[model samples]
Target: MGQGQPRRHHQVPQFYLRGFADDSDRVKVVRFGEQPRTFVTSVKNVAVEANFYKVDWLDAVREDLAEKLIGKVEDAAVEPLRLLAQHGELTVQQRGDVATWVVLQYLRGRGKRVDSVGLQKLMLRADLALGGKQRLASRLGLDDSAEVDALWDSIVVRGELADPPTMRYSHLRTMFSSTISKVAAAYVQAHWQVVTFQRRRLFTSDQPVCLWRAPDDDPGVGLLTADAVSIPLNHTTGLVIFPQIPSGITGESAPTTQYHRWFLAHTWMSAEELLILHPDDELPDWLPAYREARLGTLGLPDIQQFIDIGEAWRTHQDRSQPAAEVSF
Candidate 1:
């Protein structure tokens, strides 16, 4: 490290994603003793490590109930309105009113303003969930809150729909994970991506490792140390950060939030999970809160599984490759 000089750019080492077609499972393996020293190959039978994009509530509801709820708004009460509006299954007035109610119900579903719990429950079932108030209020094209409140009161008494029981954050958390992972998985499914692999070999002249060529250097080559991918996970930092996504495309138009979509496709988190996300900032604003709030709750056990998987993989690859039959 020296002043008055630019930070050095270490040349990245190149490697092939080699693999042979497996007979039964059909997987390719980047192996040794092959004809060409450096070449690319596809790993068909590779057991891809499952990135845990898990969620809950998938098993909570029954079969028929689940089918009815699929693509529904998800809120216990307002789901019906969203279902009808989204599916083009409602009348013009019904659709307009229901859509408005969907927005309002979502805002209030967090229970941030639950002063009168009974009224909140009533709103959840009738005015907000069922768009009962929206129906009457929209008839006169009135957006005033007083009129909507008046309508809300009218529907609850008229319908007499029972209120739902109390639920806590656990219910919300499951819904949150399910919703986020769905968006993230969809994003990843749509991104065109590449993952390269690499390996090492002995130098022809037995020269020592050198990173870069200097301005006043000799024309003859020298040994080079490069940031080689495909090494054991332990050899380097096992991370692939999507700092910034590429903009614009040649063919089809990109999504408006393409960056957000790309982020979820590459990163561990999802679009919804990153609702208040700040990808541009050097450090994420909610990193501390997320780890403290979520990770602390997971409760880790003894004997970590991936303690040295990276290192072991690198070592295995090196061992499999016979060290330069002639090191000179």
Candidate 2:
């Protein structure tokens, strides 16, 4: 609310989005729903929500703290991302910087915020089901039976009071401040590869980072459990993090199969629809696959079964449960 403070906060950093822009610095946006449409706009206008990172619970002087912190992360990652995009090379420190940026970006999206609220509601519903109304009321610190009954009805019957913006914002802040470092460390230790597409330009979304796992591998999806995580750095360049190097393939071998699966997963997770970085003169025939993928009817085979990749390296050698499912 202060003079010159940023009121429009971008979920996806503009510098990163510009990597997918055209000669005129505009990007194509495709929206999917009951009515789908396509349009072109500057990267500044997309993937942004007014005061998205504002911490309203904080004092006015520090309301934009999260935005300022996010800006620093984006600034730190600029050079490392450029190096990876241009030369596919980075020093160890640069790799860690980029990994940290990716982890934060993955968690800071609107989709993740929505997931956090949904998960909170789900856990409350589960507790109520298992512990009954009185137990749930006690857990919530409500001693009045009337208040407990009303709260239970709102959650169970009316389906209200499930989404609280302040609580969601607090959870997001906690994730960025507490959970990001551990996840980023795992990404730094994972198999890193730069993928360049000679003929096809890639699509990114409001949710840019894509986490993919083999349908049969594990139900959990996260940086540690996912067989691969990917993000398109530019129209032609992208990064894929795999659990390990495939058994016999050279480092140069692009995981094309994983790319498709990740693309599908990214499409499904997008808050709106796929972002076409560069719109083809004629709409590509494969565009339909985005919708099909979102519908779970894409019919891509279990390609991971043939990839022959090894197990993921864990941060703690003995801990189990696959690093706590950062992705849903």
Candidate 3:
């Protein structure tokens, strides 16, 4: 690569889920000027199945997301893959501290596990954390702190030190804070008009789209697009607030439930070429966040059930005809 060469930016398709209160979300037209200062925290989704289950502005976003999730594929096999990809990484929260997180699978899976220290220390390569100052100090017959600190000159200069071994792992993955919202925005832009559901259409102001698409684009918008390239984002922060005692509610009436939207920008890797953002590949700045999930946890009803099922399936496969002794 030449010094002046520009880094290539990929125009990848992206999607995200935005949730609204189920009751309020049932309506069609949403007033654009509602205030939401207190709504964000009060209506936050309670934990579900030991995991967070925020409501999506599903009614509003379904039109666009349906298309993005399914794509325009006709083949059944490819459609399943696309569906898998859409549902693949639905929820992503930090598995451990930002410094110790080493796996994307945990954060982005259909159901993610809560962050833990043992997980942080399990998946890392043995090299970056190995033979480090603490290890060196213990291995080279030197127990004193001053002596180890003295020998760490080169390591410290190279930006590798976890004094007293706090947060010895560094986050090797590159995380985009706006990753979820971006995907949502992309879906809106691509299929907003062409898709609809139950006699309702996506929300769009009569603001001229032609001007929004023109060239010599206004730099002030900070969101630019060439006919073939677009930098759209999803920064919607839609939420509702219900006071413990709103005008109509009495002690007999239940307090209203408000919905909070997680405001996010559309986040994605611009340069897919060299972003070294794998969870397990790099050691975190903290020493404790690394572990791999052995393949046994994948089957339903646990490992014992899976083994029994596997044995039965094998026996069935070996039979020439519908068998009388298939339980073996």
Candidate 4:
């Protein structure tokens, strides 16, 4: 809030973005949507939002606490990331630092913030529904019956709340503290492979940390359940992570095959693709698959269909069996 304080907070760190940048510190941004277009811009100008990490309730002096903390994490990981990108090797401590940074990058994004808020709202709604109006009002500190009735109508009947809950920077910090260790531990334990491509280049988006699940995996996916996690270290290099030595897979080449499969299931939002960073060279190989995957239509069979078929078969079997009733 002070003069010269940073108002624009980048969700994706500029230091990481610089890897995808050209020699002039510019990046080619491919905006995807109904009207997809490409343009060149400075890395600093993209993947940023005004007051993104600002804690509005905090005092001016400490308003940027989240930004400062994130900066420290980024600083610690910068060299480790650089080392991995360049030489594909890191000390144990350095690997830990990079893993922490990657986890933070995945969690501290606008999309994740939205998800947090939505989950909070869903929990609140469930609580209100389970607890009657009077109980909900009492819990919320509403003394008047009229206020309680109004609140119930607004939230339960209309599906709208006057004051929606939000996930502030402080809450985000709390989330980082609680979950960072677990998530980063998974990253550290996983087998990390640094991939350098001469025939192809990688691009990144505002939500750059790609958590990928296999086509046949369960629909519920997260860092823990992910088949692989990938992030583009630079246009020419990337880091891919997989579970430590899965069955039937051995040696160095397995990661590459897994990476390609992971790529086939990855999806991204068009709005979040505002600042896709790509190399200045020719279009990369498998561009079509990448584009199709981005649109979330890789032509793969839907997992839900199999689940539905199993459910239907179970229903048929239940109907065929003699029913028993219990009287209490």
Candidate 5:
């Protein structure tokens, strides 16, 4: 609305499974004197996710990142979204190819009537052999790439794309480069305190936080607060969203599982105003216009309608006996 005001987008929180390596006991602490090399691949992943929300690090934070890394914070701001989106799309295409191969092979292996669901599961296997792919193709009587693509899309559109068929840690590690590591280390130096179980606690933030959670955590949930946020951790990376130390809970005094810490973190984090950023430049030429046109269109349902629908659905369900029904 103002000359220098930022554009705003309503944030809709979508959950994904946490991405983290299970081993937490072996985390190496990067002390202030440790030789800092490029950890770019790791930082790139964090940056890309942040980019989707259009968040820019504060100036001081950017400088700290630069001192620790090889590139500018600006590059981190833009590149992750562009690169990761490309990676996801390409990986999906490759998976489609693999799925086709497997389907053709499966056809030849069995004389039974084809099950679409089973075929879908076969495509999901880590190593579907060339022979299997061919057998499936022969059995299904399909020689078309379009059919494969269609089948892939049918499954992917249902959120299968969230968990890609082929995810290689090495392939992703290559993206971060050493520079990103330096930035992360620098951030750790300033804000994090080492705790038991090789975890770190974050105490302050000049701006909104950049959080990553472990895979064990629920993907759909984040701890939101005025000064903190919990993000899903990237797999095979050191980046994570540390819950703040609670009022009476020190790192050593905290519960054995640290589940209570996370619980408190979630309580505080969820209370904050969610910032969802969208920049016009991030979209293709036609998309911005399309998005604008969709706003205020007739088919759109507001929050009240959603609540009404939920109420109607509940009412339709068989209720043996009801004392009271609370509405959201």
Candidate 6:
């Protein structure tokens, strides 16, 4: 190791220590490969292997939840609120409030007869499952600590509505691999970079080797090194996280996070996708009808169309199930 020599990154089988709550508590062990290996050591051991990536939860709220809800319809009326999500740089908690508001407004416009109490219950349940708090208060724009505290206590009392499955480094790695593969597919036709997949000469025959090319001068090309691997954005899925939702089957207390070990998914998009979410960007084509329906501006017939669609989605979880369920 000479002074001018470049620091080496660890080869494959990347390991990391991740925390769900605090650095010392609720830590998650992460590894990347065809199969994940349990590391008795901490993530700090190979901290130098990859750059630490932080999640912008706000972007997640907009891109993962709201944007998907809005879909491909273009909506010009809710530009202000949309801008707030895009540029206001709201916190994860704030984003949760916004998502709740959007869903309630949509349901109401469809003559759902929703009220504040119902709204509070929905918000609280979502918050509990998704790992946020003060959602009811935040949605109501109430800064009262007493109200927030009371609500928090009530939420905790509800107990864990949906318990998460037993997670392991292998599960995380398997899911993250799917995340990258999906992203690669989306960007395959894009001009920025060309990534190709091919069979590798190795013992793990199931995993395909990824080869990418960047402009000769691009520094991001360094990501091609063996040491670089995905790390959880915020101790969870980063851009996407999902709760252990109960199966539709009745009386099944033992929750399964990912039905198939190799196929793992979270409730929302991946952290890699969030990097491209920009605030100023125009709403996608799907939002306009969604917004018009939510505001009751659409004709009676059009409103019913959205209502029916919403009902169908709720009934058929397969199409609209949270990203987590699909990813895992």
Backbone collision count in every prediction? 17, 0, 36, 0, 38, 21
| Tens-digit lDDT string for candidate 4 (17-50) | 8898888888877665566767888988887899
Q: Which stretches of candidate 6 lie over 4 Å from their true place?
A: 4-6, 10-37, 47-232, 240-328
Model 2 C-alpha RMSD vs. true structure (Å) is: 12.7
- Candidate 3 residue runs with Cα over 4 Å from true position: 1-42, 47-120, 123-173, 177-195, 199-328
TM-score of 2: 0.74
User: Which 10 consecutive residues of model 1 have the lowest summed lDDT?
Assistant: 201-210
lDDT of 6 by residue, 180-222 (tens): 3333332222222111112110011001121223236543321
RMSD of 5: 24.6
Supply candidate 2's per-residue lDDT for 296: 18
Candidate 5 residues 129-188, lDDT tens each? 222333335655778867755543453223242333222222122223453343333322
lDDT of 2 by residue, 179-280 (tens): 689877777777777777666556777777777777983465776677877787887777777754433111444637566445545644643444556644
Give me the runs in candidate 5 sitting further than 4 Å from their true place: 1-156, 159-166, 170-176, 188-263, 266-328
**True lDDT of residue 306, candidate 1:** 24
Name the lDDT of candidate 6. 0.27
lDDT of 3 at 123: 21
- Cα misplacement distance, residue 223 of candidate 4 (Å): 1.5
TM-score to native of every candidate shown? 0.16, 0.74, 0.18, 0.72, 0.19, 0.18
Q: Which ten residues in a row have the lowest lDDT in candidate 6?
A: 199-208
The candidate, 2 or 6, that scores higher on lDDT is 2
| Candidate 1, 86-127: lDDT as tens digits | 232333344333323222222222221122234434444432
Name the top lDDT candidate: 2
Q: After superposing candidate 1 on the true structure, give the runs of residues whose Cα lies further than 4 Å from its correct spot.
A: 1-124, 127-167, 170-177, 191-328
